[model samples]
Target: MFHAVAKGTPYSWANRYCYTGMFCWWGSTTYRRANSPGAAVDTGWGLKFFE
Candidate 1:
């Protein structure tokens, strides 16, 4: 999905997660529909999620 978006005509990258947090505590992250590839997209806190 990420590759396709990056290569598609619009030419964009995908953000795997959105920033959700409090003053110093990070909360849940939401996936972005379309973000740019090789772009500086931050998912936050170096956290990992599994299905």
Candidate 2:
């Protein structure tokens, strides 16, 4: 997360690093562009780090 802050992370940037099992035990992501007119993706789930 610190890397995102340092690089002025863009919207949906983190989505690329997203994985089914990552460094976290459970995680989620939401997509939305600031000041943009469109529907934001609200799909997220509590997945495990290892399947």
Candidate 3:
């Protein structure tokens, strides 16, 4: 689905993280939704949801 966002190689390089404690949160390349291809473990920290 994301491969059609720009029309390039349908790919990009980024670092995404998922946390499940205190307040789980995720991070990635700020504009494009690159959260569909990574995973993370809980460290008992911050806020948000992960894909």
Best by TM-score, which number?
A: 2
Which is the better candidate, 1 or 3, if ranked by lDDT? Answer: 1
What candidate 3 gets wrong by more than 4 Å, as runs, is 1-13, 23-51
Which of candidates 1 and 3 is the stronger one according to TM-score? 1
Task: Supply the global lDDT for candidate 3.
Answer: 0.37
**Segments of candidate 1 deviating more than 4 angstroms:** 1-22, 33-35, 38-51
lDDT of 2 at 8: 52
Per-residue C-alpha lDDT of model 1 across residues 1-51, encoded as one tens digit per residue: 111222235644552333334334345654454566753544545333222
- Candidate 2 pairs with clashing backbones: none
Span of 10 residues, lowest total lDDT, candidate 1: 1-10
Error of 1 at 4 (Å): 31
User: What are the RMSD figures for all models against the true structure?
Assistant: 12.2, 8.0, 13.8
RMSD of 1: 12.2
Question: Whole-model lDDT, candidate 1?
Answer: 0.39
TM-score of each: 0.19, 0.21, 0.17
